[model samples]
Target: SNQSLLTQLLSGDEKFRIASFPTDLPLNGMGSDAPFEFASKQGLMTVMRHVHLVLSRLYPNRPVFMAGRSQGGVAAILYAQHYEDLAGAIAINPPHPDPELFRFTVQYLEDKANVLADLLHAPGVTLHDRSWEAYKTFTPSFDYPSMRSLSPILTLVSLGDPFNLFPQYAHALKAFTENDAKNQLYILDAGHNLWNRKSTDTYREVINLQAQFMVNQISKVRKAC
Candidate 1:
């Protein structure tokens, strides 16, 4: 969704091949129905399945890395959880599915009742009821192996960004990866749209930092392999 806005960042990077999947899908739609979760599993499965097919036909035994931004970030992480072959992942401002955070965000938006929420109904866009219900399913003690088990998940957040800021974001990061020193967190100095010029080039700087970190991660992985 935000990929179009991020074209400048996504483009001109040939060293690492990038693929974009367009949709509001989630990792698995077993019980929830948010626009993102509703389509996530199918979209990720479809993308990975195609990648598998392509690799099978071309170089059958090659390794690959996956990364995603916004909802795409969630998809990337979900894809890695399901696929053991995912070498590494770089997820930027992935949605935090914590119930309290979700509630707070909804209340915050509803309080503002802005055009954005009115036009789109967002996050809870489709399955507003079901998604809220599903969110309640999560608890402080809920076990999230998918997040914590991801050995090399790199999470980036912006201090002023309402989307990724919070106990929920913190929990999501913790859930996906542990407190190991291997985990790296980068805090940018702007709001959600870092690439925006109004942010005084903070977004571009974040992009450069993320790129360097990704390169270092790849090099470390290569050495380990």
Candidate 2:
């Protein structure tokens, strides 16, 4: 679905050797506590470690680029912040860095526990408490300034996202890349997930645009080296 954005990037560029993995979040409507527990700072670190190990083994001394959609986008940004060796990153429609947004999401999941369970086909599922606590500590706002020192990045924000926070996230990224003209904040005319409410043609066009953006950024990184 939305992941096609990443897939398209992989297909669009031959020079880029990218890897994709699941966040293992509980968005499948499977009604499992896994989603809640997996949505934490520790969980993200674990995933990033795995990513680092895999890329280090495969690419050795080569520079690596990271990209993701939504929560995946958040993970990309977080990983880039923690690891300075990355060549760059692309985050599409990432969650706001504000802790309150996470708190609201946790509350909404709790309040709509039954409704989510029914929708996901998990009749007795509820968001786990530990998961909620971990999520609270996963805020990214505190680190944007620090991330500014890392490699170049490109952020894609959809203007019509229902969450209404992605544009703010994009702006935050813009501030982070203020002095660096190579980094960019690209605004698209679509929903939270660009493919979600768009037509097939529009979806393809968006994916193509993202692929081109990634190619350009990677080219810039390559030339500067």
Candidate 3:
């Protein structure tokens, strides 16, 4: 699904190697790495920090950028919130990290006829109890103004995403973010998934725009330095 997106980011003859790994979070489940406890947001960030360290070490000369979609996108936001060393992050349709908004978004998915099961995880008519437990692992807590991060973020959200009401979010999450916070949100024409499947044309365009945003952002930083 993200093949076009990844390729576009690596376009322009750039030597960007994505160190893709399955995050032990419920989004992708366990991978080859020995599974450890990471039910809390603290636990989640602990693993993410290790991944950042490895990336920084492996590519010492490069500015590290994080990007992800859906849950992965939330991970990217979480990453930017904690790490000033990051160059930037691109979050595509991440659910809110606030406890109320996040929980509401979760329930919206549950009510919407297997959207969670089909789109977010395995296909099933009913979301399992185990799935709910995965979400319980995190005690969601994030405030835009108090974030300890300095890196900028580019957030892309679909205009029609019912799960996270854009209108309501604009007052708090979006409006507050613009009042000096580094995160930037851009609305797209697609549905909740951020892809124009009915129109069938924007997946590539979305990726290209994201790539361009990254380039422009990096260029500004380099010039500033």
| Each model's lDDT | 0.53, 0.59, 0.62
Arrange candidates by TM-score, highest first: which order? 3, 2, 1
Inter-residue clash pairs, candidate 2: 26-35, 29-120
TM-score of each: 0.60, 0.61, 0.71
- List where candidate 1 sits over 4 angstroms from the true fold: 1-49, 52-63, 115-147, 165-168, 171-176, 180-182, 197-200
**Ranking of all candidate structures by their lDDT, best first:** 3, 2, 1
RMSD of each: 6.9, 6.1, 4.9
| lDDT for each residue of candidate 3 in 26-126, tens digit (9 for 90 to 100) | 54221223234345556666777888888789878567778876566767777888788888888776655566666766667567645655543334534
The runs of at least 3 residues in candidate 2 whose Cα sits more than 4 Å from the true structure, single-residue gaps closed, are 1-19, 23-31, 35-43, 59-63, 99-137, 140-142, 165-182, 196-198, 220-225
* lDDT at 205, model 1: 78
What global local distance difference test value does model 2 have?
Answer: 0.59
For residues 101-131, could you state the per-residue lDDT of candidate 1 as single tens digits? 6567656544543343333323333324554
Residue 10 lDDT in candidate 2: 53
| Candidate 2 per-residue lDDT over residues 1-225, each given as its tens digit | 336655555534443455554544432222235535444555666777787778789778665677776556666776766676777777776666656555564565567665754633435655555554554455443344454435556777776654343345456556656755545677776654466443676677666776676566566667887
